[model samples]
Target: MATLAEKFGLRKASGVGEAGWGHTLIVALVSLIYFLPVLMIIFTAFKPSAQALSVPPTLSPTSLFGLIPDQFVFTPTLENFGQVFNRVMVSGSAAEPTGFDVFFFNSFFISSVSVLLALVIGTLASYGFSRYPLKGNDTYLFIILTTRMLPAIVVIIPIILMFRTVGLSGSYLGIIMLYTAFNLAFTIWMMKSFFDELSYDVEDAARIDGSSEIKVFMKICLPQVVAGLAATFVFGLILTWNEFLFALLLTGVDTRTVPVAMNQAVSSGGRGTDWTLLASIETLFLIPVFLVTFFLQNHLLRGVTFGTVKR
Candidate 1:
């Protein structure tokens, strides 16, 4: 009788092939290690307080020995979600009007507006740079990059002074403008690379066919760079979403972003350190970014590598 191994063409002495079982085992182990923290987070997100905080944490339901009261039976309640949405609980153990809803909306508004402005400004700058060679181009690029390198704290006073002079301080417009300015450097560099890789012949052909320059750009060039746009949108969204210092320093109560609001939630007295609530809010905040990456990851990879190899 042939054994199970024999049925699968595995012999006693097939050792160290590139496609060997050992390689498969190693790959599986590496994947598990990389995913462990995420799995733990998912578990904690679903757990009740005692389960979430249990010392020598139980990795599975069976570890509880089914001894938990039915009241605590991992019953998923939307109470925390309700709290996050319905009311911004105030300081103390008692719930107050924390205004997280306002913060969430502000974060979305700031991120969206900044990304739109960035793409527009970046597209123009990148197109110009791609079409024309400027003197001291390397120096210009470095100077632009340097703008991003300046410490946020170092520029806060100048920014505050500038905003104060213009009556933009602590306003949504102020923070959105600040984010757009800061994000523009990177956006231009990335989009310029994309534009440089594009075929000039296509645009030339369009010109010969009597298509205007603007038409060529709108109808021909833009289609080829859709992936670049998606990649840039993801970058700008993430930068704006996680930007805490500028949002915190530049905006007042009405314009606080999720990150700043989350931080502020912690200093609201005894309830500030509610790890469970914090975890939940963090988990919620992370979902949109995750979905964006998951959906656009293929396009981003392809766009980023578009011109790297010529076959």
Candidate 2:
């Protein structure tokens, strides 16, 4: 009878002409190592506190042989999720709203608004740059890239002062505009590359057919770069989602994002961190990001590689 390994063509080094399996094994091992922390997070978030902090760390062993605790069969509970959702927004007030809900909304609103702004402003700028061929074009692009490359801390003080002058500090509008402005340069550069790769013959033909410029752009050019739009949109979303320094410095209590909230939760009191609660919030926080990546997976690959190769 064929062995278990034999059925799937798993082989030993004894073969005369077969390729070695060592590389495959190494890759698999590295992959497992990389996922170990995530596995621990999943295991910890669902387990009860006792189980989550078990000595020598049970790894969620549920069943026991003689003294062995089996890890696979523990009952799951939604208490941690409930705790996160039910956290008091105002600690010392009569009207105690839920904190996580507000933070979640802020994160969503900021990311979404910033994405839209980047798309509109960046796409237009990219299209203009692609079509206009301005003098010192490379220098202009380099300058734009420099803005994105600079650290948030470098400009935080000046921005705060600027915001204070216009009454924009610690407001949702402030953070939204900040995120949009921060990502705008990268978006323009990326979308410009996509535009540069496109042929202008179709747009020219549309214009010669008496189509308006907007119509030509909407009908002929925009459709060709859907992948770029999706990729750039996703990048914008990620940048806003993960942005910490500016969010921390610029956000008021009402406008705090999930990342800031999570940091506050972990950094609260300074006694120690709540690993269980932290893990739960973090896992839930990542759901939207994961969903975005999953839904946009198809376009991301193609768009990210837009100008890399010629057809």
Candidate 3:
């Protein structure tokens, strides 16, 4: 008994035809629960010290009601954010800039370059595996998947030593390559699934029309899985962005990343953490990630398909 408009999602009603109040309520509750810590970081970034670490903590009780209580009431300040920015921007070594700009740049550069490289290469590898009848390919894929299962701790020492010997430690090229290696396992598998979802007819037609193999791949096939690529790229970017262990172990002054710098702040002199400053940096760190995910969410959820291929 639904209208055409409702069926197409162009129009909605309050009850069964559209998302009901119960569904909306469930989703909201789950989102709030999942994002509660992030909410804390944002609100705490604006709270003063005495208020931030008060006996009960300003944001205590953690319920919606508690968030609106008198203790949560405070004059927000930018002092903490300013302090951290100044700390990052001005505190660089002559040889290895230590400023906020350097850390931000290093993180952005390494993650961006590595993810792009991984997307290009991983998708190609996935395509090859999907289209070709190479023997033992499933076993090969399983091995590749196993690489992702290895604990980072077990491999850290070897990676560190290898980088040190090659003089790649602390270099952009080094981190980018290392990240590409780490990301390949997941990206390859993910791309393979997406490519498999498409029929081989498009590529075959292109090839029959005298298109080269590369052209068939680039022009005929890649376009159909755009949504999958976006999702994979987002996944790869997040892995690289949030990477801490290798970045910390292998990188030095010149190439240290945000996560490393954040840890250094908390570890400095063993004094208790700088709460306000920590919260401020955390909030700023969240912006790029949030925007990327939000923009790509549509593509990620619905994905794309080139209408059904003819038999």
lDDT of 2 by residue, 1-311 (tens): 76543443445433333556897788789999998988788767776665666566766435555454455455566677766776544457453334889999999999999988989999999998998878988888888888667677887889988988998878999999988988898899989988987877767888999999999888878887888998888887888898888888889999999998888876676647667777888788878987997898766644333333355
TM-scores of the candidates in the order shown: 0.79, 0.80, 0.86
Better of 2 and 3 by TM-score: 3
Candidate 3 lDDT over 1-311, as tens digits, reads 76554443432443243778899899999999999999988988888876887766666434465557776566588877766656543246332333767888888889989998988899999998998848999998998887678789888888888988999998888999999987888889999999998877777888899999889888878987888888998988888898999998888887899999988875575567878778888887778877988998766765456336655
Q: Ranking under TM-score, best-scoring first?
A: 3, 2, 1
**Candidate 3 vs. true structure, TM-score:** 0.86
Candidate number with the higher lDDT (1 or 2): 2
What are the Cα lDDT values of the candidates?
Answer: 0.77, 0.79, 0.80
Model 1 bad stretches (over 4 Å) = 1-39, 60-77, 86-97, 303-311
Q: How much lDDT does candidate 1 score?
A: 0.77
Ranking by lDDT: 3, 2, 1
Candidate 1 per-residue lDDT over residues 192-277, each given as its tens digit: 88888888887898999999989998888877787898899898899889988888778988988999998877556565366556
